[model samples]
Target: MEYMKNYKHWLANVKEEERAELVALASDEKELKERFALPLAFGTAGMRGTLGLGTFRMNEYTVARATQGLADYIKEQGKDAMERGVVISYDTRRMSYEFAMKAARVLAANGVNAYLFENVRPVPICSFAVGYLGTFSGIMITASHNPKEYNGYKVYGSDGAQLSPEATARVVSFIEKRDYFGVPEATVDPSRENVMGKDNVKLCDHITVMGKSVDEAYFDRIAKLSLSPEAVAKEGGNLKIVYTPLHGSGYKPVTEILSRMQIPYNVVPEQAEPDPEFPTVKMPNPEMPDALTLGIKLAETLGSDVVIGTDPDADRMGVAVRTNKGEFVLLTGNQTGVLLMDYILRRHKEKGTLPQNAAVVKTIVTTSLAEKVAASYGAACYDVLTGFKFIGEKIDLFQKTGAHTFLFGYEESYGYLAGTHAKDKDAVVSTMLFAEMVCYYKSVGVSLYDRLQEIYKTLGYYAEKTISVYFKGLDGMEIMANKTKALRKVDIREIAGWKVASTVDFLAGEKTYSSGKKEKIDFPKSDVMKYFLEGGDWVAIRPSGTEPKLKLYVSASATTAEKAAEKAAALLDQMKGYVE
Candidate 1:
């Protein structure tokens, strides 16, 4: 009844065109309830959902309401915050540009300056612009790697990181008080040509359209992050690469960076341009193997040794390298993270640029091999919760205290950041670094695959597998919560014949050992569980923060790759049994 009431309210308030869409759904009870049973959740990462006319879907009204709440929060910070403005950027998703303009206009209506981009941009650049332009905050209109039906809103602090939990909570409090239809409309039409930055156009009082200058500064900063320019100079011309943006926002920037670095690369023409439909791929996510099929085929045609794919927002990257047998194999996120870490550290050490306080950060679900690699180079590795924001927070902390120099940060989901220029995972920089890495390895007569094998031989084989079980429909959230709750109550002693040495309940912020000793986990409480086995193996179970699924991650290490793979597979299978 409440959902029905909300649906009717939305249908009545929306425009004639939007009302038609809702009217069509009136007869579909399931669809109506799915779209109105709850308001699209606005967490620290912001909200994401289907594009439709409902309380739970993303639309002009929803974007406007969220922006109004953000404006209120900025107003709390005072007039200076209003003058500082907020950077706004979007990808090529359907209505992405419209949603971005809507947010900009809403912020402008609330008397907050909105520095909207002239055209589409990726997440990293938006994050970078917050700090680069001295903005009070930043907003990115993207769903990252989600399907085409979904779009999202991400808020960033002045530090260029996603808002902290406390900050997000404050913003949400203001957001909850606002009525979607009551938010004030834009006082001015800033979308006109005269409002743009080009042709010496005079910007409006509350809105500024940003262009090339921000990108130039961002590219310049990324160029300074190249550790092996000489290697790139030597092998760049010969080491051909195939890149595919998967019809998202990565095409221009990814190509421009490779050209700047003088790296020889080919782009899959079918996916070289921005298409909101993402026609060439089922999902615009690089983490999915099918997304790279075009890129890999082009690689084979061009005799390229590497294929790189960036997601819809270009915040995450995935790679497939040619092996010794002349076969292309996709590298898992864990493998890519470790390889990049090893390459960065080794190069820095060779050039004597490696800081004595160098450090790397990875999510708790990431491969433990990073620790072994970091230690081999006399660097420290730290684990954080499963978000790039935690990594960004650490980068901010390192800058304040001088405790450690942040070298690199990554999660197990193909997101990576190498430079402090952008506080979020940057596929632009990651693409640049990986291209340079391939060149660097080629200069030493080693393929990327061979180097990976060598690292395994030295550090011992490490295998990691991640599996997600979906829970669709309105009951998805409730089911996932109940499943995690049930798991928390069970004392899992062993999994796949591996003894559980300890179990960590992150929601309770406690790690209980088999010896009956309990230690507090010095991290924020989250609905997550991690088990440490007899060996250096680990398995983590947690509900996905952004999607309707429970994710299980397992990592197993052994003297050989086969054994490690087998162990990891078994552990993952057994872990699934516990949840399902």
Candidate 2:
């Protein structure tokens, strides 16, 4: 914390009105300590924290430090590195613009030009820009679905994915070892401002600050991701669809793409605009049905066939489909992922484009139906560690060898990617695919809800549930860490009504096969416990990487939805007692 005590001049160059705001934050002991406590560590999902004055917080100084480290690393690569500048964009979070500018200034000060977005942008757009502009890296100021109290910085590599572990760790080492906190207040102003002053910075030949052109590129890309552009053009008028951005940056790009595809759709005007407060919804998450209640209501009133929503940054997506029973039912994230997998596989197989080297990737926590889908088509299905980054890594591997063509990738958290263009979960592409898929189903005189039932009948009916127990504050992190450790020591594993068939301890990187063979599991180390049970039911336990909560993932199969859901709910209830 003392490392930052001397850099008091950070953010000092702001206008007088903003200077007063910074002074107020500095004067508040709690805020200053929160901001100065520790450097904002980049966790699995990138850097996120409550915005304020602390080193542990998201602010001008922290962004500068991170940017400075990034710039240092880039410049150290040699003279050619100066030609590769970074692209920077921000969302609607309070002071996101100022923070982004601070980061750009730091990069500029270090001789790394930053193509700063002059306006708010969604996360996927930033990902698209990194690849489109051929930049050294990309920076997005967003907290995704987190509450308004928080903001974040997501770093993207040239391939438009999060930094690989090795690269990120190197950056972390740079950040931790630097005397970032000790940089004098007097010099910080010019150090940052001078970077943006044109003398020190050099823009990449292709890396320019783009606003609408990138959006159009994404729209064009999403159009190609469509399953049936012709069908959408033919019967799009009959396809009634409702989309809500949850009051975030998804509003503009999505609208443009849908219009370009000639797909007729209605936007929930109340939630169409980018409002960081997410006014229409209680919480801006489609995974929570409550978050989509307003959109659902609007869809119902419009008599739309389906409703879809994107998170604040438009990476993950939540959707609503009318059930077989003629009522609105929110599909779980696993359900949506599996359904998309089936849709893609089914379409490709029918079109004779199903490659012998086709591959589908999914997180282990996601539903097992993806396994069935890949097997049905004689394609390979790979289960990655539980995060889109792992899936993106798999894509990177495939891109190198052409051993397989990427068919689809998803996690059970409303994140999916079908095309190879973007490495991360892309709500823009997913949203377009969903709209096109709905159009396809409409052309066949079947609803998406009905198509899902057909999938269940073919692929064994699968049910899944997530149980979360909150462990808040610093002490809470300690307790959760301990509890996760304790689970690794337990021997007897039968739970609720299932017999443990095998177990995978991710923390220890061990998996005991039911065949009595023990093998090493090679994935990034995570504090996770997974047990596959008898009769195809499985359970996974892990603490939420982004939040202070221990989470349980349960998946089961049955002959019917009633049985599957019943068994899942009961087992989840029993597993509740295990949380510390």
For 1-580, candidate 2 gives per-residue lDDT tens digits of 4634632644454446556666767556655544554567775456888776556777766777777677777877755665677888887767777777767667766667577764677777787788887888888888888888788888888788888888887777777666544422212333333332232233332223446666667677766766676778877877777888888878877777777777777888888877767676666777887888887898889888888899888888999989767689898888888878888888888888888899999998888877887798888999888878888889989999989899899999899898877888888888888888888887888888888888889888888898779987545667888888877767636787577788898888888866767889987777888888877688889987767789898888899989999888877887777675
Q: Kindly list the per-residue Cα lDDT of model 1 for residues 1-580, writing each as its tens digit.
A: 9999998888778888777888889799999889898888999899998887788888888898899999999999999999998999999999998888788878888889988888889999999999999999999999988888999999999999999989899999999899889787565544574433452132566878888889999999999999999999999988889999888888889999999998888999999888988998888988888999998888988888899999989999999998899999999999999999999999999999999999999999999999999999999999999999999999999999999999999998999999799999999999999999998888888889999999999989999999899998889889999999999889899999999999999999999999989999899898899999987799999998977899999999999999999999999998998888
* Candidate 2 residue pairs in clash (backbone atoms < 3 Å): 3-181, 4-181, 34-54, 35-53, 35-54, 35-55, 36-54, 36-55, 108-195, 109-195
**Alpha-carbon error at 47 in model 2, in Å?**
0.8
As a TM-score, model 1 comes out at 0.98
lDDT at 311 for candidate 1?
94
Candidate 2 local Cα displacement, residue 49, angstroms: 0.5
lDDT of candidate 2 at residue 98, scale 0 to 100: 75
- Candidate 2, overall lDDT? 0.77
